[model samples]
Target: MARQLDEQIAGRFQVGQRLRVLDVGMGQGTQALRLARAGHTVTGVEQDTTMIAAARRDLAAEPEGIRDRVRIILSDGRDTGVHFLPGSFDVVLCHGVLMYVADPDPLLAGLARMLAPGGLLSLLVRNGDALAMRPGLSGDWAGALAAFDSNSYRNRLGLDARADRLDTLTATLAAIAAPLHAWYGVRVFTDLAPDGAEPPADLDALLAAEDRAGRTDPYRGVAALLHLCGVRD
Candidate 1:
């Protein structure tokens, strides 16, 4: 996903351009710090105090140069309008957040508004259309059957969550004037991997295979997660 984002940034902007990045729900400030290291000015918005503490601890370890590139805000994604103006960012990231929101469309629209012309809006979401794939392959026929008609499910954390279909999201982005630029499947063949499990010795090869399938046809459609990027008009 990092490589994909860098590709978009490189293709959309000139060399060494310092970008203004807004990272919504930036857990532990991982992506925010990474972007700052890459020379972008990043502002991370997170509502969780624990997460903010963790991010701050991590930030404290970096040199002053890197620390100066980041700003941590104690607010959720919905507060963007109150914190910044329209077209305030060259990139807006909303990853692993839509599932938790009861009303995601308006939230998405707000995120799109923060992007400048031709700026990137990156989203990571559960694939609603492929919700049945996991249970089906696991031989849970009843669960699979139930999932076929529903876009809501309980995540591993035991929280009720919603998912978005690609078609629906595509139309929404179009209406928002930030049409889909490129999308890729994530966790296609790796969804079943156990949490905190060690990587296999063939980690690179496995990732290569996953990356190839993510960009290819049919296989990508059944992936567990979808990575969608939209460009502001």
Candidate 2:
């Protein structure tokens, strides 16, 4: 996911452009710190106190130069308006967050509002259209059947979450004046891999195959996650 986002950013902006970045639901500040290290000014907003503390700890460990580029805030993603002015950021990231939101439209609109014209909105979401693939591949007949009828499922963390269909999100983005620009499937072949599973001996080769499938046709359609990039108009 990080690699993909880096590619997108590189494609849209020049190196050392010093973009303003807002990472919503930035757990542990992984992406936030990475962008800051790359010369972007990043602000990480996280509601979880433990996650905020962990992110701060990680930030503190960085050299002063890198650490100075990042700021961590404690707030829900929906409250972006409270913390920032409209069009404050050049890049808005809401990765791995929408599934927990019961009503994602309002939150998405708020995020869009934070983007300057032509700013990028990067979203990582669970794929509703492919929800049945996991259960069916795992031999869970009942779960697979249930998935075919609904977008809600129990995630690996045992939390009830909802997935999003690409079409629905595309339309929503258009309505918000941030049309979808590009999208790629994530974890196309490794969605069923067991937790903590180590990479195979040919890790590079495996990743190459996964990367190809993520951008290909039928395979991408059934991927576990979707990485959607929208551009604010």
Best by TM-score: 1
- lDDT for every model? 0.93, 0.94
TM value for model 2: 0.97
Best of the candidates, lDDT:
2
Which run of 10 residues does model 1 get worst, by summed lDDT? 1-10
Off by over 4 Å in 1: none
Over the stretch 1-233, how does candidate 1's per-residue lDDT look in tens digits? 77667878898989999999999999899899999999999999999999999999999999999999999999878979999999999999998999999888898999999999999999999999999988888898998999999999888878999999999999999999899999999888999888899999999999898988988999999999999999999
Candidate 2 residue lDDT tens string, 1-233: 77678888888888879999999999999999989988889999999999999999999999999999998888889999999999999999998999999999999999999999999999999999999999999999999999999989999999999999999999999999899998999999999889999889999898888888888899999999999999999
**Any idea what lDDT model 2 has?**
0.94
Q: Could you estimate the TM-score for every candidate?
A: 0.97, 0.97
For all candidates, what are the clash counts? 0, 0
Pairs with backbone N, CA or C atoms under 3 Å apart (clashes), candidate 2: none
